[model samples]
Target: MIMRQAWLSSQVLSRVEPNGQAASVWRFFAGALFPIQLGSRGVRRIKNIAYGPEGRKHLLDIYLPKGPATAPMPVLLHVHGGGWIVGSKHQQAQPLIQYMASQGWLVIDINYRLAPWNRMPVMIQDVIRAVAWTKANITSYNGDPDFVALTGGSAGGHLVALAALASNVDGLRPELGDADCTVDACIPVYGLYDLLDQNQAMEVGVGEIRSFMTRFVMPKSYSEDAALWEKISPINHISPSAPPMLILHGQHDSLADLESAKAFAESLSRISKNKVTFVDLPGQQHAYDCAYSPPAPEHARAVHRFLESVRKDKQR
Candidate 1:
């Protein structure tokens, strides 16, 4: 019962509004258990940087590593998942950004407009714009613009995967008129790849997918926009030029499911010559990395190993 209560409290804490209340909650949580929970070196150089137009869902936070800014570090651009309806980068992705910074990678966690307020292409645009912004200005944060990687979990993972899949799509190209927006690698954790399949699965309470469809795109039911669903689904777009990918899915995640990860890997391997690694995490669920109060040894080791392998491949 205590654990259940704590889980409910965590969800409530996530919904607490106002910047002050949010900060207070962050501080309270950070102080109580986080200090002793993880070994990551917390750096305060993180700051929110807006990339899109004025108003909502136009910002991102860049977490800079505490070290000399002389050499460019590999960049990780993360998107947070709230079923595409509700979420804040400050809450969902801050700790992960901090951890990446501690690992010597500059991290940028993006905030894109959710559904009802915005539509399908708009969120995609927001993500691509964030990529463009990072590619153009991340050097200031000691991040190598040329080596940018995209990552996220659940809905965020879908966006990351979509961004990676759309890297070569002429329509999805950013209007920044700057350097290329291509990412060097991808890490999508428990991301929904097939929107239609996910929507169908969510009918049985697989996740909040039914709501995501309503919030994120025009028309509540995915059936209304069959073509659009196909257009935006990451599983539909795979090519040989697609960036190398590392997909991690928990076996216990009924939300995103392990099949999606396997399907993505199979698609990449069969259709694209790019490297695709699938890590099947045992007995874990979606958003397992969001446990800011405790350490996730399995996730950490898997991610560390994948990053190392990708870095080595980059060196070659």
Candidate 2:
């Protein structure tokens, strides 16, 4: 741990644009380390709301602030990260959900079908369905449906980014015909950006994804379905209207490629008119925000600030 902190002190630097929200290594270590703070005391958790027809996988939890609000609060729809295989709505999101809930934000934590049993598009479809449900019903929970923001780490990150940026993507299911997947903003942490790897340029950690995805995640062989792989890659779907995004990837992340993550943020910054902030968290592992520590608390606070900015923008 000491070595990790020392290495981090030398390696981490945040890259952001338009707003200049750089992740300073000094900033990273400046905050005193805190214990793993889970849920916030200020929030009320209403669990197991079915967001879809599927049984447990389609259920979500509503983390609403306990007190009455001045108006409908901004909504945060979280898709948990576990590559594409293992994770749940509550998996690894406790710190963020608790903190955001305390901030008077209405947070929707959701679970989706994993791969092997469920293939590609099913996960994305589940995300879309959840968004549809949020849009249709969030008002009852004192959530402003108009300002829904999507966030997640790793696989969750990929899904949120795809659902927000890929506006032209056809609704994968017949039931989702005309279901709007638009979101006001997104924050993808240590997310896989370009899964296609056409250039074969992705670094080491990505090689494992190619094999793993082909076996359980992808419906067909890579040779037989390169296009689908490209289709699901979030970097492949960037458009001019991508929601404001803050991309955070660990400098030491082996699961999500760092260079590709940087490129993804840079690409979004180039194409989208919305603000894009990218932070290279030093010495932090992937899914660092799931814990309570320097970068985690600092970054979560940053996300809250970003969501606040997005909410204010939506109101105007």
Off by over 4 Å in 2: 1-34, 171-174, 198-201
Best by TM-score: 2
In candidate 2, clashing pairs total 1
Report the lDDT tens digits of candidate 2 across residue range 1-316: 8446533532333223224555555535543454455466688899999999899999999998887899888899999988788988777767678878888889999989998899998898888889889998999988988889999999999988887877447644326667676889998888988886643557775668888898889898779987778888888878888899988887788778888888788878999988888878667677767765565555666678777877677778
Backbone clashes under 3 angstroms, per model = 1, 1
Q: What is the lDDT of candidate 2?
A: 0.78
* Tens-digit lDDT track of model 1 for 1-316: 4333333333333332212222234443453465334335656456567787855578777777665766788888888887777787766644556667777788787788887666676677778888888888887766788788888888889989999988546555557665577888888888888766642333344346556575555543566766666777888788888888888776677777677567667767787776787766545577867765422322443454566567778889
Give residue 76's error in model 1 in angstroms.
Answer: 0.5
Question: What TM-score would you give candidate 2 relative to the actual structure?
Answer: 0.88
Cα misplacement distance, residue 282 of candidate 1 (Å): 1.7
lDDT of 2 at 275: 87
Worst 10 residues of 1 by lDDT: 14-23
